[model samples]
Target: MMTDLVLIEQFDSRTAAEVARSILEANDIPVTFEADDAGEMIPHLAPVRLMVGSADEAEAREILSEAMKSTDEAGEEGVDGEPTA
Candidate 1:
């Protein structure tokens, strides 16, 4: 049977996409990634899409949002008295 997958976010880098996938998976939410070019032939043309089932979309989004918020807060901290741009 086919599952209804919902697009959560798109990433320019595979590492970022995989990290999101890992976060969702750790929470018991199934996730998958789709990309046009697997070999990174054209960096600008490639986009890694993170997808989750429609049923888990809300929870997955919440988890990612929290993670992003934390990341943003961490970035806001000044490094050596200089704030990160």
Candidate 2:
């Protein structure tokens, strides 16, 4: 595994970030998150940083974009019912 981690996305809530992480992992991409809450909180008050290997940055972004778009199409936004546009 490459140690060069790169921040690919920042989500307002832990649920959003976890969803993104699941999307990435489902595609066989390794990811890491940086947050103060240790993935226990459900608030959108703080941002969560989603990261992947530098070599996987482009792929990770594309996957996340598609995931978010699909969620938009499904009439859901940001995992907590917040508007995404």
Candidate 3:
């Protein structure tokens, strides 16, 4: 019975926002996905906002940032120390 009402972070791509939303939800934090339909109408418009609750806002952003960092690190790594192909 929790509600999502905090604007935690914004991303240019829906994919990234979705990934962030998933991370917050997985961590037991309530999340709401707000798609930028306006951006869809105009690709140059503002990015989409990934919001959560006020109480969990800070924690959610930290979780998302950490997740993003881990993803970046993983992408930088490769099997046998070889670059990704």
Candidate 4:
């Protein structure tokens, strides 16, 4: 059986998209990446897209949101190698 997929997000690089794919997969959510990089010759014209089944859209977003929030909090704690007050 095939499922309908919905676009969840787009990343400028394949590495970023792969990271997101790993996260979703770890949580039991299936994901696929789409890109049109023209064989790595026109990276600027290609954006990696993260997609998940329509039925999993909301749960996927929630998981991604929490993960991104945690990442943001960690990055915000220090600025240019200096601790923030």
Candidate 5:
């Protein structure tokens, strides 16, 4: 049986999208990456789309949200190559 895939996120870099895909997959959420960059000959030529089954969208988003939220928090705390006060 085939399931409907929904675009849940997009990233300018494939590496970021790969990280998102890894997170979703690790959570047991089905996901795929969509991009048209001449078969990755030029990955930055287009944004990478992170897709999940329509049924999995919410869970996938929540997982990603939590992950990104932590990243944002770290940045706010000055963890990106900077010392935190």
Candidate 6:
């Protein structure tokens, strides 16, 4: 399908992709999942991808950015110097 906008987010795991998808849906944007065929043998292919249309590109990027920022912050140590990781 031809899209006016397409953004790619690489997730460390499939669950992360799903979470991202849900976030987009919750915000009223349409999302489509793309993945290498399970039956295919492409080792270099990503297992899952969350796709947002061109119209929602900006909002999608914001949502993804926020998710990544929160994830990064969660990995940092608190003011007391206790590492969350």
TM-score of 3: 0.74
> Which ranges in model 6 have alpha carbons more than 4 Å from their true place?
1-5, 39-47, 78-81
Q: How well does each candidate superpose onto the true structure, as a TM-score?
A: 0.84, 0.75, 0.74, 0.85, 0.84, 0.69
Model 1: residues with Cα > 4 Å off, grouped in runs: 79-85
Better of 1 and 3 by lDDT: 1
- Computed on alpha carbons, the lDDT of every model, listed in order, comes to 0.87, 0.84, 0.78, 0.88, 0.86, 0.74
TM-score of 2: 0.75
User: What lDDT tens digits, residue by residue, belong to model 6 across residues 1-85?
Assistant: 4365485565645667779988888998888867674534552466666777888888889988898898788779777879864
Worst 10 residues of 3 by lDDT: 36-45
The best candidate in terms of TM-score: 4
- For residues 1-85, write the lDDT of model 5, one tens digit per residue: 2189899999988889989988888998878888988888997888999898899888888999999998887776664667676
> Per-residue lDDT of 39-76 in model 2, one digit per residue for the tens?
45545546799999999999999988888788667785
lDDT of 3 by residue, 6-80 (tens): 787888877777777778889998887677567577644667787777888888878877988988888886967
Query: What is the C-alpha lDDT profile of model 4 across 1-85, one tens digit per residue?
Result: 2199899999998888888899999999999988999866787788999999999999999999998998888887785766577
RMSD of each: 2.3, 5.7, 2.8, 2.6, 2.7, 3.8
> Model 3 Cα RMSD, Å?
2.8
* Model 3 / residue 5 / CA error / Å: 2.4
- Each candidate's number of clashing pairs is 0, 0, 0, 0, 0, 1
Worst 10 residues of 5 by lDDT: 76-85
